[model samples]
Target: MMDSPDSLVYLDGVSKLYATPQGLLPAVRQVTLDVRAGEFYSLLGSSGSGKTTTLRLIGGFEIPDSGRVMLGGEDVTQLPPHRRNLHTVFQNYALFPHLNVAQNIAYPLKIAQLPSAEIKLRVEAALEMFRITGLGERRPAQLSGGQQQRVALARALIGRPKVLLLDEPLSALDAKIREEVRQELRELQRQTNLTFIYVTHDQEEALALSDRVAVMQQGRVEQVGSPREIYDCPASLFVAQFIGKANFLTGRVLQTDPLTVMVQNLPIRASAMGYQPQLDETVTLMIRPEQLQIAESQPDAAPTAVQAATQAAAQLSVNQLSGRVIGDTYVGQLLQVQIETALGRLTATVLGKASLSSEVNLTWLVSACTVIPPALATMPSP
Candidate 1:
């Protein structure tokens, strides 16, 4: 694929391998990505997914076995880290123990051989920009995790690099501080208008902080899109299960137009999105827990078996299912309820409360659920 004209960083068919005791193992395999200028793009995946390796390749710290890494339309795949127009803020903050915060932020400028007076002025401005002006004299050991993170970011941006690469910079901070820093990071990126390529294994962090995210697995990208696209319309089962909580139900395709599938002797209507599944082909249906609506069932109005079957058939036109509550847990403002239905056990995140072992009706629109083909099924055209 051609790189976008506005892309500040472009990875073209990049691949990396490591020589271990077990022999050569691929860490990044034929990955291609384009990060638009001034956009917050993230590489998101668990450990061993090669996200950090990919970031290192971009930073020119790790040489790829094949392909090129381009920054601002110039190939820098073989260049040294200092030669690239980018700086990396590592997970541990990597602050020098002996240097105070001002000196740490000024180190990059010092290395550039700027005038002493200019360096002092820039360091003061950076400290004020990062809200650490009063703590400039404190060493890394004397500061909090969040303060250290600010020092690291200040040091990185002090160089005014074209792109800033972060490798889980907030992972060491406590939850509250992490959130605060995450928001500050986003705001800083917008305020500076600098492109940011962040690497993280935390799905929530990626979804909340990034303008777009690339989901990586086994050294390959599964999907790349906006957070809402990744969460609401995942491209594969892996992505569906990885980004958030999803409930899956397997069924065989009964029809193609306005796609219908049969699950547990009940016909389920689902949206095909862009996928085309053939009749008789088994497919999995996925729905988010929050998409389902649950209500208490009227036990006094319970219908006979035949009437219930008729009602089920009629309800198939929409999406409705009857289930008995098996579990209920309070999570913040929402209630996580698990129910046992004919198809299988499903979890629903709803407001209010639900009693355990009580019959309830679950309803959702056909568009609320997506049809995912089997592993061997052909993927939709790009």
Candidate 2:
């Protein structure tokens, strides 16, 4: 993968094994990842998914049991933490209670033995960058949680580390403050041109902030792709269910084509990205809530594409599903509608502003459906 134009960090088949009481627990299993230069990469997963372990390996905090971690074309798998050009922002905001903000930000520079004037200059710059200049005189306890978090950030960035490791840095903050800090982190990274490895379990945050996201499950990575790619083109049922909210239909494949697949007694034609699965094979048809459309059908669309409308009973044909709106709930800017179709219960998210009827009946373009082969490795395309 480094044969690409801009590969900056490489993890080659890295694995970590722990001797548990029951048996060996593999925290990370043969995961290979390539981070391009200046990319805001997020290792997204639940706790114990190896996201933190990956970050520590990259930062030289822990050595991998197998494989190598490379940075800037050099192998640093065995390098000590002090020898690595990296900085870490812990979730706990590991600030020194005895020290003020200025002192805390200056700690790293002091350890590096920089001149007093230079340390002061760097601390001032970091405080100014985080917009916490005035709070620098206050101890961590004297500041708000947000301010204290920024102090931790300033401390990490003060040393001008080539790579920044953020271990759920915003997880400790409340929702309102978390949003603010996440934005600050992105802006700080862009302005400083720093490569960041962010670990987070929040799907929205990962999608909003990362240029690329690595979705890990159990001990191995399930998919490595852009947020859009992973969100829309989930490679596995686990991914489809994990990354965000998704509705899947399980059925037996009867026919197939590059543009469509006949599964679960439904003919699903996706937007030019379908694959041919063997007949009689169990397959899952996956579709996001937002991808589906409701109400009257449009001109120049397929007759078999839209699901059968409950109101227009006689007009139904082709891929039309026979389902009823089981429930509809308002979710801020969207309406999540659950329907009982022939395939099973499926959810569709309509725009908040969209005009909805009490008894919802809908039709979707064939291009919106994704046919996922059951137990298959590759996921259904968007």
Give per-residue lDDT, candidate 2, residue 107. 95
Model 1, runs deviating above 4 Å: 302-317, 373-382
Per-residue lDDT tens digits for candidate 1, residues 1-382, read 7878988999998999999999999999889999999999999999999999999999998999998999999999999998998999999989999999999999999999999999999999999988898998998999988889999999999999999999999999999788888989999999999999999999999999999999999788888999998888888898889998999999899988878989869988888883678999888889999999899899788689999898777665559889999998899999999999998999999999999999999988788788764563453221
Top lDDT: which candidate number?
1
**Model 2 agreement with the true structure over 45-113: per-residue lDDT tens digits:** 999998888888898888999988988888999999998888998878889989988999999999999
Q: How much RMSD separates candidate 1 from the native structure?
A: 3.5
State the lDDT at 22 in candidate 1: 100
